[model samples]
Each structure stands twice: as C-alpha cells, then as structure tokens.
Target: MDLQAQIEREGFPPGTSVIPLAEPGGQLFRATQDGGTRGLELLLTNEAVRMYGAGPSLALVLSRLRERAERGLPPALAPGVYERQVFVGD
Candidate 1:
C-alpha cells in the first residue's frame, strides 16, 4: 500500500497533513495544526532508537503530532535541508 493509503488504513485523523519525502522507505513529514513539523522515517530491520526516526507505527507519529499541535510549539528547524548524523541503536 502507498503512504496515504497506509495512513488511512492506520486511521489517522481526517485532514492530517503528511508530506511524502522523495527518499525511499516510506519516509514523510507531518505538519501539525500549530505549525510544528516532524519527519517520519521507518526503522530498518531490528533497529531501535535513532535520529530522525519515527516510532514503530504511524499511529504513534500521529499521536505525537497531535500533542505537539495542542501545545502550539514552533517549528524545530528551518525550511531548508541540512546534513545531520543518524545513529541507529540496537
């Protein structure tokens, strides 16, 4: 299934804005109503904690985004892309 279809299957709230990334592995970013943005990435096989990594499921990511929206937090980073380290933990 595609990202949007998966999200709908996962039952994310209606009108949730998800921007699909051009990269592989179903990566995407969700924008909260409060203007906060979070990048979501799938974990590799057996991987645990890591940078720019989302939770084990899309539901979790939606829940987190909901919380952020309620809190009205500003965007964590600027619009442009930048290089950053991504560490995968066991």
Candidate 2:
C-alpha cells in the first residue's frame, strides 16, 4: 500500500510526521508529533515470534494512531527501532 497516502487520509494532528524506515527485508515505520514527545514505532509483518503471525493492516494502524494523537495520548508503544519479534498481534 501507499504509506504516504494512508497517512494523509489518516489525518494525523498538525505537525505529526510519519516516515518509513529502510530496514532490509522488513517493513517498519515511525510516527512522531509535538517535537517527538509522542511517537510510535510501527512494524508491518505477517509473522511474529511467540504470538499471532499477522497484525492489523497499515491503514488500520495509522487510523488508530491518528485517533490517539487527536486525543493527545502518547503512542501505544515507545518510539524507536524495534526487533520484528517484539510486536504482538493486532
């Protein structure tokens, strides 16, 4: 999917920024706002270790994250690069 288009449709709060990470053989993204006080590390994968293999769609995840940002909530996950195995099921 086109990540940038999804981000625009997600309507993140003003100043919010989402960027795709250049992780070889993996899909990863980062979202940040308020000068980085609030952020999320999003990893897109169809498999995870010790957990359900599939996670939510990228559009769905972006929508939820946008909702949280609109409500002034911190990211559900801490901001940073993370191993793919760390994420659980959507």
lDDT of 2 by residue, 11-75 (tens): 78899887767555446666777776667666655443224332245655566667766777464
User: How do the predictions measure up, each by TM-score?
Assistant: 0.39, 0.60
lDDT of 1 by residue, 22-60 (tens): 434333444433333532222232232243354554455
All-Cα superposition RMSD per candidate: 6.4, 5.3
Candidate number of the best TM-score: 2
> What local distance difference test score does each model get?
0.42, 0.59
Worst 10 residues of 1 by lDDT: 40-49
Estimate candidate 2's alpha-carbon lDDT, on a 0 to 1 scale: 0.59
Clash tally, candidates in order = 0, 0
